[model samples]
Structure formats: C-alpha cells, structure tokens
Target: MQPLSSVQYQFPLQSLNTFGIAAHAHAYLRVTNTEQLIGVYADAHWRALPRLVLGGGSNVLLTGDFSGLVLHLALEGKQVVGGNETHHFVRAAAGENWHAFVQWTLAQGLGGLENLSLIPGTVGASPIQNIGAYGLEIKDVLHCVTVFDPRDGITRTMNAAACGFAYRDSVFKREAGRDLVILDVTFALPRSWQPNLRYAELAQAVAEQGYAVPTAQQVADTVIAIRRRKLPDPAVIGNAGSFFKNPVVSRAQCAALLERFPALVHHAQPDGSEKLAAGWLIDQCGWKGRNLGAAGVYPKQALVLVNNGGATGAEVVALAQAIQADVMAKYGVALEAEPVFV
Candidate 1:
C-alpha cells in the first residue's frame, strides 16, 4: 500500500460546510469503497494519523485546520431488497447526498423518508446522529447499518436496537465516534405509511388547507417548503441547520419551569424527561437574529447559528458558547452543540 503521505487533500474547508468555517485538514482520504477504506486505514502514514471523516460537510463546524488526514466518504450505491408494496427494503451508500436520496425515494412513491426531506448530510452520517426533522427520525425507518469497525478491523452490521438512538443522538455520536466507519445504511420504508400529523406546525399547515389524508409526496413537499423557509440554503449562506440539539430535561425541571413561566414551551416525551425546545429558549433570551462578530444566529431560526459571510470556526464556537451560557444561566438548561467538532 502506498503511504498516505502521497494521498491528496483539497485543503481549506471554507465552503464545504453549511457554515463556511475556514479550516484545513493536513491529510484527506476519499474512500470510494470498502477496499479503499482498508487501504486508507492500513497505510502506515494514515494508521497513526489523526483523521476526520467528511461527507457532504453539512452538519459540522471545523474550529481550525486539522493537522491530520480528513477521510472523505465518497462511496455511492443504492438498491432495493425484498418486500412488496406494503413494505420495502433499501440500501444506500454513505456518500449519497441525503436530500437527493429522499427526493429519489419520494419519486419512487416511498413514504417513510418523506417527512425528513431536505435534511443535509450523507447517508453514512445519518445514522451517526440519527438525523431528525419534521415529525420523523431516521431511526423510525432504519433497519441496519453496515459499518467498518476499527476495533478489530472488521465489518459489522448493527440494528436499531444496537444503535442506541435517542433524540438527535446515537452511539456513533457518543463513545462510538471513531470506532466505526459507516459503510451503508439499510431502511425498511413502508409504502402504505399513514401520514404522521402529530407535530403542531405540520398539523396546522394541513388543517389550514383542509387536507384530510395527504399523500407522501405532499408530505415531502410541505416539509421541504417549511425547511426552506426556516433554513438558509447552504449554497447561499453558511450554516449548520440547527446549532444545538433540543434539551431534554427531567419532568420535575419541566414542571418547575412551566410553573414559573406559565407558558414555557415543552414537549412531553415517552421517556421520563421533557423535551425543551432549544429555539424557544434562545428566542426568549433574544438570541434570534443576534449577530456577534462574523457569527450570528439565523434571523428566522433561533436554533441555527449562521456564518454571515466568512466566519471563523472559533468565532462560531464562541457565539454558541455564549448562547449556551446565557440559556443555562437564565433557564438552567444546558444547550449541547449539534455539530461534531474534532
């Protein structure tokens, strides 16, 4: 195997991410297949190399130029397995664009991924954080993930039960970060999926239009429209959709906060904790549309931290820290950043 020292890197990741934070990786690996991945990790130069796996670069903020190889997953493959119209099985490569895949599935009349339309990131990274939007999460439709485990250098398959998916979190985001390199993801999307009209925004939009049973395409379109209105196009503006995950707190804390504010916005979770809307808290604290240095909170989305023009990663991180501190000081809620920072 050739040394990774000769491997190429397209440096200065300024425009790769939604938030165009200027950062650079000393080494870059674009692994297009399982064999390439093995070669990448086996290379002596890359073996001890500090590395970062980059996909579409949608949900991350690089604080500075990495001094190691940045492995970019560019693998792409998609297919259908078994099952009739009622249920369908599909597999997608990690490098596949997430929004494009959702659109393609909708074109195929697939219903499961419609509600999560327009989310950014790659197929491989989707299971990393279990990306969720609208009223659906990736875990709802996920069957298994094909991962290249670094522990013993073997490929392993994991199901949802082993993924440890929670609200915007999974094992990949926790202690499993560098342990696995997601190869492909398989999902069991149902054709006869009934519309989930639970989220208030979606419900209101449907009721206002007086639609009783909306089709999967309609759901995809609606969700896309809503997201478009809230999130700035990464091509137009630099941002990582939501800067922080919604904070889930103990029921007791929710009760205490609701009693104090009387109109505190909170979602009841099946778990014992109450999900606090991070946006609402940020908005309440007047972080919405607030700008500091080159970083700013998106005007329409208080939860999103935006790069007005050429914000440094450190600048964005500082703003996030300020917002976190403010929310914690005011509401006793700690805001956790969504982007995976190395």
Candidate 2:
C-alpha cells in the first residue's frame, strides 16, 4: 500500500456508504484496472492485505473502521458486445454507475433495465446480490458476469443459471462468489419492447401520468418518482435503502400467516413460493421509526434501517438482531439482511 497515492491512509468511509456511518480504513485503494489489482494482489503483503471491494457503496452500512485495504472500483466503460433473437447484449465495466448505465440503455432504445432505474451501487456489485426493486431483479437482465478469480488468479465468465439466482441473492454472494472479483458484467436487454407494468405502484403512476401505454423512458421516470417518494436520497439523509430482503416462505408457511392475518400482503412466485412484504411485517411488529440507541428503522419504510447519528456498528447489528428475533418468534419467519457485512 506504499508508493501509491491511489491508495490513501486512514480514509473516512462515511461518505462512501449511503448510510453515512463514519468509519475508517487502515488503507484504501482505488483500483481502476485489473492489472492494478493483480499487482497489488501479488504483493508479498497479500497475506496481510485487508482487502474489501467497493463500487457505489450504497447498499452498505459502515459501523466501524475496517482494519484492511478497501479497494474502490473506479474502472468505467459501457458497450454492446452481442445480440440475440430479441435481446441485445450490453456490457458495462464493474465500476460503471448503475443508474447512469440504465439511462444510457434507455437512450439506446434498450428496455429491460428501465425498471431498475434510480437503484444505487455499481454494475459489479449488482449481480452478487441479485438486486431487485419494483418487482424486477438483476437476474432477469443478466446474461453472465466476467470475473477475476482471486483464488486461482484467472479470468472466467459464468452464465445466469450458474449464478444460482434466488430472491435478492445469487451464487456470487455465496462462498464461491466471494472468491470472484467482478471485472465487468453483461446484460441482455430487449431491442424491441414490452414494458413491464406488473408492479402496482408503477401501474398507478402510468394511470396518474395519463400514459395509456408508457414508453420505456416514461416507465423509468415514473419508477424514479415512486422510489424517491419511498427511499431517501442518500445525499439528503444517511440511508442504505432497504436494509432487509423480503422474507420468502413456502406456500404452507405463507398459508399459516394468512390464516392469522387475513389482510396480510404477499407476492406469489411461479415456484409455489411467496414473498412476504418485509416492511409490512416490520411495521406490523411496530419497529418502524422506533430508535434503539442511535440506530433505528426508517419512519416511512420499516425495512430500511437508518442511523440517527452517533450509532456504532454494534448498535446497528443489535437492532437488526432484535427485529429478526421478534419476527421469528412472532411469525416463525426469518428476515435476512441485504447488506454484505465485512
């Protein structure tokens, strides 16, 4: 981590994370190329390089100083590398800003990424979490991801099925995914269009906007508006967007809940599974806007855990544990976190 101004010392990571939690890194690196990463990885200090990969830093909550090297991806580019019967292949660098890339795709007349507008983070981090918002997930648009294997020190690409995409998760996030450092990602976006209006709020926006059959860009605008209404702009207030993934349960488990709370809301999947509204459950449990120490649930959205200043990572983790334990005990359903804890 020496002889490199690209690497900084005692860097405050508060501005990096959306939640704006003040923290520090023993050392930090802004890797703009694979060669740069390999050079650093080959150092004899490899055994001691406290490594952390970063993109937009939106979906993370920084509770404390990371006693390691945080490598912030700064490489950026976008292009169309392939095509298919109806969909065209659009490729983006790992460090490319996600929303900017989505807007670019819309400008190029691509359709699939529109619903993902205004989502924070980078293209590299998107696949690992299988990020979803407004009824659409990254898996639907992913063709495959090209990654540099840190273990074997090689490059490879894995297809969608191999990603093992599930609700807000993928194999990349699994034990294997951690070994893979994302270099770039390729998405399959349809050239011809069929706008997805399956999301209730989106449809309502279409109706309210008087768009009989909204164009792809129009859909994106409406979705952006709705998201702004729900999720706080990280610039204005510290936040990590939604802090928990929706609890996916078996049909039988969902049936049990429905029997108890007839007005319970859920979205059914084709695989005979159902996704419970996690925000609803949190609110029903009366955790919304309730502060514990310095960490608390967002007032408007329960699933979003926010820092009200002076909160430590331990405090945040404690609050999350309380919420998880309460839900498990009350409804027999477990809520999982979306942020990857280091």
| Top model number, TM-score | 1
Over 4 Å off in model 1, which ranges? Answer: 4-6, 84-86
lDDT of 1 at 338: 89
lDDT of each: 0.84, 0.85
Q: Which candidate is the best by lDDT?
A: 2
Output candidate 2 Cα RMSD: 1.7
Q: What is the alpha-carbon lDDT of model 1 when measured against the actual structure?
A: 0.84
* lDDT of each residue in 97-133, candidate 2, tens digit only: 9999999998988888889999988989898888887
Global fold similarity of model 1 (TM-score) = 0.95
For model 2, where is the 10-residue window of minimal lDDT? 41-50
Query: What tens digits encode model 1's per-residue C-alpha lDDT throughout 30-76?
Result: 77878877877666767787878888898788888889887788999
| Residue pairs in clash, model 2 | 50-69, 172-177
